[model samples]
Target: MSDLKLTRRQSLVLGAGALFALGTRGAFSQDATTLTFWSVRLNTPELQAALLPILAQFEAEHPGIKVVNEPVSGNLVYPKFLTAVQGQLMPDVAEAYSYHPLQFAALGQMAEMDDLIKSWETSGRLKDVVNEFAYKKFFWNDHYWGVPYNLDPRAIYYRKDLLEAKGIKPPTNWDEFQAAAIALNDPANGVYGLSFPAGNFHITQHFFMGFMFQAGGSILDKDGNLVFGTTARDANIRALTYLTDFATKHKVTPEGIGSWDTPDAHTFFQQGRAAFGMGTGVLIGEIQRGNPDLIDKIGILETLQGPAAKLTAGFFNPMFVWNYSPAKEAAMTFVDWFTQPGRLEPLYAANPGGLWPIFKSEFDSELTRSQPLMQEMLAKVIPYTTDFAYPGTGVPEMGVIDGEKMFAAPVNEVVIGQKTPAQAIDDAQAKMAALWEE
Candidate 1:
C-alpha cells in the first residue's frame, strides 16, 4: 500500500492492495491471482463460445485465481505483441497461430516449460496423452516453447468417382501424379485436375514444404541452415515442376485458381470443377453439408509422400507464455489440464469429421471400428503420414514476406511458367539470402 507492489519473484498475480497505473509503462507486478492472456487469432464468437466456459470453470474451482480473456486479435494484437513484450505487459497465457511462437522463441519472449513437461512425462497423464505433434512442436531448439492445442492434418481430397471413372489410380510418384493430373484435367470442360489458392501463404507453404520433404529436402537442416544442394535443391525444383504443370503446362488447374486461396479450392471442389483439392481434414464435415451425395465419392489420402514423403507438418493454435508473465505457474497448470486426454476427447468429438488426431493417445482401441471412413484414415492404408511444425517465419510480418513472398511465390512462379526452376531458385535464393542472413 505504501508504494509497494508485488514482484513475480514473490508470487504470481499480485492481489488485494496491489494495483497497476496504465499508460506510464512502469514495471509493476500485482499481488492478485489474476492472469492476463492475449492472442493473434481474432476472438471469434465460436472460440469464445467454446473456451470462455472452460476458463470460467477453472476460475470457479480456483477461487484464488481470476482469469481474463483479452480480445487482442485483428489490428489490436499482432503489433501489440512486440510492443507489449517491450513494455513487459505480455499476458499470462495467450492463443497464437501455428508458427507464431517461433518468432517469440527467437526473441526469448516465451517462457520455458521443461519442468512442466518433465513433470507431465513422469505423471501417467503425459503417457495417456496422445497428441505427439503437439509434444514435438512444443520443444524448440532445446526447450519447450508452446503447447499444440488444436491442430489438423492437411489431406488431399479428390473426386473418387472421377479418378475411378478415368481409370486413374491415385499417383504414387511425381511422374505418375502429373500424368494422372493430365488425364483427369479437362479445363475446356470446366474441370481442373487440381485447384489452388494463390496468395494464402499458409496453404501454399504447406504444399510446397510437402513436396520439398518428399523429395528428401528440408527448409532447414538440424543446425537451422537452409537445406540446399542437389538433393534438397532438386527437391525444390521437382515441387515447382509439378506445381506449374497443373496450370502452366497441362492446363488442368485454371489460371483463375491461382488467384484465389484455400477457400477457392473449397468452392472449386464443392462445385465439382476441380478433381483434386488439398484442405484440412476437418473440411470433410463441411463437404458433407454441401455435397451430401458425393460424400462417399470423395477420396481421402495422407499427404502425398516426397522423397521423404512421410514427413509433413501440422498447424496448431498453441498455448504460449510470456517471459514477463507473473503467473506462469498457474497458467501452465491450466494448459496441462486443458490438454489432458480426457479433456481432448470431448474436444475431438465436438467436430466429428475427417481430421486425423495429432496425439497418438487421442486415438484408442475403442476407435478401431468407430466408422468406415475414420477406419481408413486410422488404418492409414498408405502406411505412412508426415507432420509439419513451425517454419522459420513465425511472426505475422515475417510469414508474409519471407514465407509468402520470398519462399512460396517464386516456386509458384516456376510452376506457372513465369520463371524456370533455375531462375525461380535464383530469385528466391537472392531474396532469402538478403532477408535471412544477418
Candidate 2:
C-alpha cells in the first residue's frame, strides 16, 4: 500500500480525459491576493448555514484576506469550475475529493503538499492520524496531494429495542449477522431483519466492497492484476445473495430494494419498516431531527467483519490547494487553520449529524465518548474500520457498479435454486471482467 502503486485496472479509473478538463488558466498573480475558495458545500443555504460561522471565524483570524466561497451543486461541478478556470477565475483554495486527488494532482490544478506537510510537522501542527494506506490515498507517484480535513466511514445501524425484544444480539461477524438476519426477519410481524440498497451502487457499493474484502475477494491485488474469480468471489456472491434474498427469496425486505439510492434507503429506515441500515453518521441525525424516539431505539456498529479483513471506504470532505493558486501559502494557511483542533472540534461536535472528527484525540475525548449513539458505536467500529481509498473515477466506480448490478440482480436467482453461488459469481465476474477490460 505504501508503494502507492496503481493497479492496471486503477489506471483506467482516473481516466485522462476527465483530467484534461481541469481548469489551468493561471491569470492571478501570487500577491494580487484574493483567496477565492471553491466548494459545493458553501454554495447551498443548507451548507452555508453551517459554513458561514466557520467563515466568520476564518476571517477573524486573517484580517487582510477576503474569502469568496463558491459552491457548485450537483450536476454543475464540471461546467462551474471548468468555466472559472478557463476564464482565469480559479479558487485560491478548492475542496476536492480524496478519490479525485490523483486526477487533479496530475492535472497541475492542485499543488504538491509535501513541503506544507513537512512544515506542519516541524511546527507540531500536523496530525495525520489516519492509517498509512489512507494517508497514501492522497499521495500518489511522489507527492502529497491533499490535506484531509474531514473523513467519512460506513457504520451499521440497527434497532436496539427490537433486537432486545426479540432476544437477539447484534452481529459481531458474518455468521452471526446471517443468523440475526434470519431471526429478526419476521415480515408477518412487520420487521425485516436487515436492509440494504438493493439496486443502487451509490447506496450499496461502499458497503459491498467492505463485504467483498471481508469475504476474501478484491477487484485487484496490490500488483494491480484483476483478481475476480476466487473463493472470495464466491463469498461476495453469497454475501449479496443474502442481501437481495432478504427481499426476493426470504421476503424479509421489500422486492426491488436494490433500485433505491441513499435517500430512498434513509426514508425506508425513517418509516421504521426496516430493522437496520448502513450509512454514514449523518443519516442518524436526519432521522432524529424528526423522531427523537427513534434515537433511543437505534444502536451503531462498524460494518461486520468478513474473512479477508474489514475493508471499507472512509468518507472525507477533503481539502486541496490549487497547484496554480495565486496564493498557495495563503491557501495552505487557511487549510492549517481550519484543521487545528481548537478551531474544528467544537464545530464538528456541534453538528452531531455530520461526520465525527478525524483526530482520535477528539474522537476519544469525554466530550465525544459521553454521547451514546454513534459514540458508543465507535467502540464496535474503531478496531475494525479500514479506509480503502474510495474507488475513484469511472474505471473503478464503473467496474464496481457494474459488478454490483450484475451480481445483486441474480442473487435471487441462486437463492431460488435457479443457479449455484459459484455459477452466479462466474456470470457476475465475467461481466465485470469485460467492463474492467474496457
Candidate 3:
C-alpha cells in the first residue's frame, strides 16, 4: 500500500485515502449499501467510545447499510472536505460549520434535506428541537442543505465573588459592563477586570459582530449588500471603539489582551487573574476541571446589551448529505435517526457544555434541565444568538473574509492604537467589499 498524502488548507490525515479505497471496493459490492461519513471530534477515545455504539445501532437497524466513519481534525475538516468535493470523492454525510454547507450548496454539491425532513415522522417537531435562529441559519434558498447538530453560543463569564466584593452587579448593558470592568481592575492585586481575545482571528471578529449587532449594525443588509461602510459604518465604529477601549483606553483588561486568544483568556480566568471573560460554555468545563474552587464563584450571563439590541455572537456545527453520494437516502436516514432526542442525548452527555442541543425539546428535557449552565444559556443567551456570518444574509464570501482575517486586521489596528475606530472600520469595510469582487 502506498502512503497517501492530502493537502490543501491544512494537512489532515492520509486516512482519507483509506476512505477512497473503501469507496472503490464498495462500488464493486452491489449487494451492500455503504455510506461514508467524514466527521470531527471523534478522534478522542471518549468521543469514539460514545459514537461507535450509535453507528453500530444504526447498522443493526438497517443491515444492508454500512457506515464507514472517518475522523478529521477540526481545523482541517472543511478544507479536506473541499478537497474531497474537488476530487469527486465526497462523503455521503460530512460534518461542517454552518457556512460550509452554504458554500457547498452554492456549488450544487450539497443535497437539500428539506424533503427528507418534511417526510420524516419527527420532522414536525424539528422547529421545537432546533431554535428559530438556527433554523434560519441552516435554511437558505428555500431549502435546508444541512441539519443543525451542535450549537455554541457566547456569554459573559464573571467571577461572582469579585463582583459581590466590589459592590458591582452583573452588567446588563454596555455602559454598565464598562463600568463594572473598570471597577474590578486592580493591577497591584494582580487581577484584571476582563480578559478579551483581541489577537485571535475568529474570536476578534465574533466579539466585533456581537457589539455591532447590539449597536443595530449588521455586516450585510436585507438586500444582501455590504452595509459595513454605508449604513452601518458609525455603529461599527462604535463597536470597535468600545472593544478597543477595554485594553487601550480604560486599561481594564490585561496589558497583553491584544495578543490573547480564547484559550489565553480561559487560562487567565481559571488562574484567577481576571474577573470576567467572554466565551462559550467550554469555559464552565475548564473552570470545573482546572479551578474547581471557582465553580460556585463563577457565574454566566448573557452578552451585554448594546444601545439598539441585546445579542450574543454564536456558531453552529451542522451535518449535510452530499448531492453526489450514491447513498443519499441511507445517509438521510442516518441523519434523521441521529438527530432523534434519544440518540442525541448520549452524544450531548459525552461532551456537556461543549455541544449544546439544537432542539427545543432537548432543552426542556430532564437531561438538559440537569445542567444549570445550559438551562441558563437556553433562557438567557440562545434567544438572542446570531452567527458571525450574519444570519439570513450570509454570503459564502463572508466565510473567506472571516477565515482570512480580513475583518480581524482592522480590529487589530484599533486594538493596537495604530488606527482610530473609524479608520479601522473603514479599512475593514473596503477589504470586505473587495472580497465580494474576487
Taking every candidate in turn, the Cα RMSD to the unseen true structure, in Å, is: 7.1, 5.5, 5.2
Cα RMSD, model 1: 7.1
Q: Which stretches of candidate 1 lie over 4 Å from their true place?
A: 1-32, 39-42, 71-77, 86-88, 124-133, 228-231, 345-357, 364-405
- Residue lDDT tens for model 1, 324-427: 56576778877777666545443344444533344556665354355444555555422344334323323222332332345667656665457787677667
lDDT of 3 by residue, 87-146 (tens): 667788877565777666755567888876576435565556555556556666678888
Candidate numbers sorted by lDDT from highest down = 3, 2, 1
Which residue segments of model 3 deviate by more than 4 Å? 1-28, 41-43, 120-122
Q: Roughly what TM-score does model 3 have, to 2 decimal places?
A: 0.89
Q: Ten consecutive residues with minimal summed lDDT in candidate 1?
A: 9-18
TM-score of 1: 0.80
Instruction: After the best TM-score superposition of candidate 2, give how far the Cα of residue 250 lies from its true spot, in angstroms.
Output: 3.4
Against the hidden reference, what TM-scores do the models get? 0.80, 0.80, 0.89
Instruction: Please name the candidate that would achieve the greatest TM-score relative to the true structure.
Output: 3
Q: List the global CA lDDT of all models.
A: 0.59, 0.60, 0.73
**Model with the higher TM-score, candidate 2 or 3:** 3
TM-score of 2: 0.80
